[model samples]
Target: MKSKMLTVLFMFFTMYSGFSQDFQGKATYESKTQVNMDFGNRQIPEDRKKEIMERMKKANEKTYELVFNAKESLYEEDEKLEQPGGNSGRGRGFRAMGSAGGDLYKNIEDGRYLIKNELFGKIFLIEDDLEKLDWKLESDTKQIGKYTAYKAVAVKTVKRPNMQALFRRRNTDGKDGEGTKEKKVEEFIEKEVEIVAWYTPEIPINQGPADYWGLPGLILAVSDDVTTIVCSKITLNPKEKIEIKAPKKGKKVTQAEYDEISREKMKEMRENFRGGRGGGRGGARF
Candidate 1:
């Protein structure tokens, strides 16, 4: 038994050592977030609710590509052509509420990350140390494609927009405009949610899509409370090497600072919406 164990360890070490030299890989991910179409206490026609849900579904589903080496990775969304006559403005608003659309560069060896985020027509380079999650590795295993995957779970506290408030119908009776203003103060709130990730040792790279890393292998699938990001395809050591570089074209700020900026912007938009200065003739759509 000891000899067999030694042989397994030797093979793992050999594979890792081979990859450590000049390994580069590209992974494509499909991300989708489940939208709660429930508008609390809002009386809307069923047809209109269906239309809003469809728009939200389109905005929530996205594709991303991650280019990685031994210690560094760059994850960015795969661009798609906008459909003609599509509501681009409403789509953008929903996307802004969902996830950060940016070039995310992570350096696991150095414990740092840099994200080039464009929010509200302004660009920001969010530079900060990676927030390490206390992952509890599980013995569960499953097959993802040809690779065997192990599961890990963690609980994370994240700030999320109050979707109910955002979608709630405002009293147009002009009796409680002040109350609306006060409610906008809690546009975002912190909530704790569980994250589940499945990593495969076959790739033997401590990398994953987005800001996830520090596993024994490459992550094949990860899901949080609302969103699930899964690797659809992976290419290892392609003929053309992909460059993983941190983006440089933005005003630098820490993650906390950027969050504050985003929150303030959302607050301002909410105020504008309350004051009937938000959207076009139909008022804010979804």
Candidate 2:
């Protein structure tokens, strides 16, 4: 009975120990990404191309955050946002129909410290190419931030959930905005993506923009294929408390489970919408 009672008390203490302390800081980096698709040898109208490019503009300029602490570290790369030049988007994430976004996550709190800041690390994403891969790492190096930081490299392996290589289809009736029917076919789809990041323990704040964490420090900068996030500056332990957040709460799945869910959701979206504007405004990244 004493042993059981001790175990229960230990569990209680552990749960209560997770009260995150107050912190304030900024994370920033540059991102670069490529969006490709097949037009099926069909010629896309100029207007359609213009519209797609507009969407791409938003995708390339999205932002994402990485968060970490003593418990877990997750990376949600390339999250898109509703507005441009904002701090809400995930890491260099891309999307198609609705609002393009980015998100990446991982849980490594229960594991060993392994390599603090190596030259390269492998990361994995959900896509036809990455679906088979159990894991993929990337290159990194130690640096400085609010504290000691490690530099992460770019892989370009992951892609945005809603993102796809699209080719425009000409409308049958080209009466210049006269209700001309248009078609958009997927040209390319890839899941693997690479990003460079900088993490530090300066303020000992383990919060990033999106699902990024795991370093002995916090993420100060991140970037995707074409987009980059640079934490120009930050202030530690302000008057309020700041907690890291997942792309979307209510996620009751492991890494593999989340990948499966995201994949199925994207697949369903593509099938249901076909050549129309499908999916919601949420942004899911590669």
Query: Tens digit of lDDT per residue, candidate 1, span 88-135?
Result: 432244224224578889988899999887775567788899889898
- Let me know the TM-score candidate 1 reaches against the reference structure: 0.85
| Candidate 1 wrongly placed segments (more than 4 Å) | 1-14, 37-43, 87-91, 94-99, 169-185, 279-286
Error of 2 at 223 (Å): 3.1
Error of 2 at 211 (Å): 3.4
Give a tens-digit lDDT track for model 2, residues 65-168: 44444443333344343566654433222233111233333334433211111001112232111112121222334545445455545354553443432223
Q: What is the TM-score of each candidate against the true structure?
A: 0.85, 0.47
For candidate 1, what is the lDDT? 0.76
**Candidate 2 residue runs with Cα over 4 Å from true position:** 1-34, 63-194, 200-209, 243-251, 272-286
